[model samples]
Target: MLAAVALAFDMTSVLALMYPGRERVEILGQDGVTYVYACKPGPAGETPAAQAAKAQAAFEENATKFGEAFAAELMQGIEAGAPTLGMALDMTRKTDGWAGAITAHLEKTYGCALLG
Candidate 1:
């Protein structure tokens, strides 16, 4: 199924991103799903602030595309069922809910009380 393929791809991508020196980070969403990723070290001579900025930039770049793709896949799954239009609309509203959950998890894990 497409969902299975997507999950497989996600797992493989996570594994491919991992390296010996990379930091292993696990973020548990309120939805009960856990996202695992390996954060790579910043480039040589880069300041901590610069590294954080770069990480944020990279996260935003990939998150948008991944979110869109996931939304489309979820819509496809809904369409395959006999859901009503109202149900579809409700589901669409939650397309970006995962982002909030992830952000919460990250903030809590990193002790970033000021994260928005």
Candidate 2:
């Protein structure tokens, strides 16, 4: 249920971020999920306010795209591995092994942090 909701939000973000005339983008994963964030390099004389606004727009756009793709990809993987991974995580949590392993897995694999 929670995963579904999160996935929806991510998808929505992606739609919102898909803007025209944007460039210089890269994607990354933090904990266990992939993400897309935008970065731009330009003239040095741009004012702070303008730079902030540009960065904010770019970041938001990148975030939206990243979230949508991440959710879609996650759903595909979860469909394939949920039964085993879910069980493992639950049992590991009960045994205090879930934290490090899960966090590390997400960080190394997806670059997304466990929200929680």
* Top candidate, metric TM-score: 1
Residue 96, model 2, lDDT: 57
Task: Return the TM-score for each candidate structure.
Answer: 0.37, 0.35
Tell me the tens digit of each residue's lDDT in model 2 across 30-98. Answer: 344433322222356544334334444444455566558656756775777767567556544543543
Which runs in model 1 stand beyond 4 Å of their true positions?
1-41, 82-116
lDDT agreement of model 2 with the native: 0.44
- lDDT against the true structure, per candidate, is 0.50, 0.44
lDDT of 1 by residue, 30-103 (tens): 44555444444344654434443444544555567767876786777777884667666756666557666655
lDDT for position 35 in model 2: 39
Q: Candidate 2: deviation at residue 62, Å?
A: 0.7
